[model samples]
Structure formats: structure tokens, C-alpha cells
Target: MLRVCFTAEDLLRVRFADEPAPMVELMLAVATLQRSEAVFGLWRRRMGRALTRSAGPLLELVPATGKGPLFLDPPIPGFDAGLEHVLSTPTALVRSELHRVHARDRAPSPWTRLLADRDRDSWQNLEHALRTAHTHIVAAPWERIRAGFDAERAWRTHLLAGQGIHAMLTGLAPTARWRETTLEFDSTDDVEVSLDGTGITVLPSVYWTGRPLVGRYAQGWFLVYPAVTPLPDIDDPTSTDTLAMLLGRTRATILEQLLRPRTGSDLVRDLGLAKSSVSEHTKALRAARLITAQRDGKAIWHSCTPLGLELLACLPESRGKPA
Candidate 1:
């Protein structure tokens, strides 16, 4: 089992990886597929319309570095020296035009900071944290509660107990400080933690969900500490074969699920199986290149690869009349 701490670095890596390819393509396509002036004109028009209609802030999100036009700090110092020359010249017209050029030429926008905020609030991350916590409970099998704990209550207890442990282990206060804490569960008996801490708790559950525990000191939300383990290295062929052998019925179920995109937890709940089993089967299918798995927070979703579909098409029906 992989012991993982939900850290900013880990979250950033996941964000970078999971950002849709289409968004990148759209940006590139706008520049290359259309005339440069036409592209700029369109952008300017859009900005003008938006500014005209909105009293709210106008914000543009820029990448820190790489393939797109240099918006943020350049890889090399003094790379943007020429920017002043262009913006200062008469060619730079409308204020929006200058803003666009500055955005394109200046250091990356502070939008990343805003993004960080949203990432902290994302539900997807919360789900991931919960799954991770459950896995930990299963692996270690915490003293089973005397009464049958519903998913929600179990999660709440786990979060509270885990928070206590997290404080002991990390020596850090909960990221989401709380004057009061409470827990909630989903329809499936899944758990959720709400906190009222001044800041969000960097606990496992929060890490998985990427949501900050939000609330005031006197009326704070619950804090959940999830048990997280390292994700096993699934790339090893031996690991793949072993997982595949163990999968049996799970293999068929996963294959069917991957005919379309499905999240890890979705598979586990739908199949009425343990998360470890789902994860193991997913690892095998992913290794075989029969399916592709992409991480969206704690949940890693899977889908059938073209190769997998082709292979499936070729399989002979066992009871077919034809040989």
C-alpha cells in the first residue's frame, strides 16, 4: 500500500497532469489556425464585451512556463526586455490590447493563486481523501467500532480520530481550524469531514479532496484525517500479472466499466467490492494497455484504449456455432 500525504506539490502534479488536453489544443489552435491579427482581434472583442458587461474583476489565467506564449517569467532572464518596446509603441492601441499584450508578455498572472484556492475547495479532492482513508482503515483494520458504523458515522469517527493522530504525527495544527467539528456521509455511507479552522487542514481526507476545512472558530466544521498509503508501482509486469491473476471476475467487470470513463470509487461501489481489489485490477488493465487510467484528485478514472477495444472485438465467442 502506498502511504501518501496530500501535499501541495502532489496536488500540483495531479493538476498539471489532469488538465484537459483540449484546453491546450484550443489555445494553440487559436494562434496557429487563425491569422495572428484575427486571433488578437477576436480576443480583444471578447474582452471588450466582457468588460462592458461586468462590474466584477477581469481575470486571465496564465501558465507558469512552457509551450504557450511566454506569459509568466521567462525561462531566461531578460527574455522579455523587448516587451516594453512593443507595448510602448503606437501599434499598441485599446487598453484591452495593451492588457492582452502585457498579459502575453509579462510574468504569469496571479490566477494561479486563485486556482490554488479553487483546488483547495474541490469536491473531487475530498472524495480522493475519503477513499485513501478507507484504504488505510482496511489495511490496518482500526479497532472495529463496537456498533456497526454507518458509512457517514464511520467516516466522521475516522476523521476525528485521524485528526488527533495527524496532530501527533505532524505537529501541525489542522489546516482548517475549527471551533467545532462535525461529519457527514453520502448516500452510499461514504464519509465527509467539515472543519471550522482558520485555515484548512492538510489532513489525508483534505488531501484526497483538495478541499479546505472551512468555518469560524466558534462554529467550525469537522476535520477528517484519512489514512493514505503510497500507490503501488503498477508499471512492473510482475505486478500486473499477479494482479490480473487475482482479478478473475473483477477483470471482466473492469473491462466492461472501461468501455466508457469511470472513476475508481465508482467502480468499487458499483461492483460491491473492496477498493484494493478495484485498484489492483485497474493497475493490471492499465499495464496491459487495454485501458487508460487518469487521476482526477484521489480517484483515478479508467477508460478502454483503442487497442483494448480492437482486441475485444477479435475474441471468439465460446458458445458460437461457428468454429
Candidate 2:
């Protein structure tokens, strides 16, 4: 069991992450991918089919059962910036973390030894692997991930408003319990932490479908737990090819991009199309009531309607139900 003793100050400092940190989410996905739990089987198989061996070096560092080095996932804002931070970890910290990982695993692999010794070539290979993995695993599903975060925030916010913090914390799961100022939950490690006014960030995870993860990080402490709500359309093999065949590639691409609100310029730049092409596609989309547009001064923002989202969620051959 993991128990966290919190002070009043710590309670005051408790909060939610506004946006899912890319590095943090990526690391969680990597760890979750290693799991053999039945709940994760479908997700793992799909991701495994999609991902290449480009992520091997990272996998070498983060074992399935043991905690990875904290430096691999600092509470940074941007994904690339976070990767840069991981690569630039202090030599002493790298050695210490790798040694800790080794202690838990009880084996001496060649990569671990070279990494512990601060080998420059090994570092380069690691950097390449991490970047390649991020491109494949996180890039495509990012918008859906962001949507999941938004849903989590809304759900938690409602809970906080209606019940209060104690109810919010203890209500995380059936087994989670609160002892006055302390919160306790099941964990692999039997650990206790006193949050000495350094309050923790409470996050709802989409990838980490396991027991609650409570640990101190570079920024501070984080209590990341699994979210009950699954991401809409994340599981479905996006029938983009079908959508493309129906809508034509450009229109289909524009429709997918409109999952989030975007301006004409945003579409043009993002899709690498001309301004006229975006305007033409959006006009057809709006005419069909597949999307809605709002005027924000000079810019007209376009977003997918429920019809559009439903269309994406349930298309022919999509594995999802038919619309």
C-alpha cells in the first residue's frame, strides 16, 4: 500500500494538469504497452501492430514491472523539450537512476552497463529511439488524448464542486481510502510519503490502466490514476481510407483535422494545402452540416459537428457501429 500524509498546505496545493504532458503520457503509454493485462490486450495489439522497433532503446530502460528512471518523464510542457531534458539529464542522476533500475531487475545488461557508464554512443541511440517512438505512438492519437484530458477535467471539476476535496480523493476507487489528512491506495511498493506543503498534481490517465501511481517527480509529487471514461474513437481503427474514398482525400483530411477547432489558415498550414482548397472543402462540409463555422473577427473557426464526429466514429468497415 502507498500512503500519502498531506498537510493543509498540501491540500491547498493539490490541483489537476490543464493539458496532458506529452512526455508523461508517452512514458505511461510505454509502460502500459508492456503490461499483459486483459484490459489492455486490444489496445496493446493495435499499438504493437502500428509501432516499429524504433522504441527499443527506451524499452531497455523502462521495464514492464519496475519503475523507469524519473528523468525520462519530467513535468515539462512540450514533448520535444521534454525529450531534450531527458537527453541532458545530469550524468550523476543518470547513473543513480540506472543503478536503481538495475537493483530492482537484478541483472546486468550491456546497454544498462554502458548507460551507467555514461556512454555517448548509447545516448545517441537512445535519443533516436525515443524520438522515433514518439512520432509513431503519440503523434497520431494526440487529439483524442487531449479530448480525454478535457473530459477528465470536466468530470473531476464537477465532483470537486459538488462534494469537496476529501470526497474527490477518496472516491477515486473502491479500495482507495482516506485517513484524516492521509490518502492511501494499493501499490506494488509499500511506501509512505509526507507532502510537506509540496502538494501533488492529481492526473487522470488514459494509458495507465493500472493501480494508482503516486510518486515525487522533478517538479513535485503526482498522483496519476486511471480514468474511468475511455477515449471516444481511440479504439476504432479510424476508417480514414473509407472516409477518403467517400469524401476524397483532401476533404477527408480536412474533416479529420476539424476534430479540433481550426481556422482557415490553420487548415491551410496544417494540411499543406492552398487557402482556396480549405475554403472549398469547408464550404462543402458546412453545407452538408458535417461541420460548423464560427466567425472570430477576421478568422472563421471550423469544428466537427456531432454529425461529423459520429460519422468518423461509425463508418463502414470501421470496427465501430454503423452510423
Number of the top-ranking candidate, with TM-score as the measure? 2
Model 1, 184-213: lDDT tens per residue? 222221334322223332222211111222
**For every model in order, what is the number of clashing pairs?**
30, 0
Pairing residues by index, what is the TM-score of model 1?
0.23
Q: Give the local distance difference test score of model 2.
A: 0.73
Error of 2 at 67 (Å): 1.7
RMSD of 1: 22.0
Q: Give the backbone clash total of model 1.
A: 30
Question: For residues 1-323, could you state the per-residue lDDT of candidate 2 as single tens digits?
Answer: 88999999999998987777777777777887788855567878877766546676677777775268888877667788898899888989988888887788656579878877889998888888778778866777776676666655655665676668886787565468888898998777888999999998987766665677776777889887766433322322333344543344566678888889999999888778888767867875774456899999999999998767865665535222222
Instruction: Compute each candidate's TM-score over C-alphas.
Output: 0.23, 0.70
Off by over 4 Å in 2: 49-52, 230-323
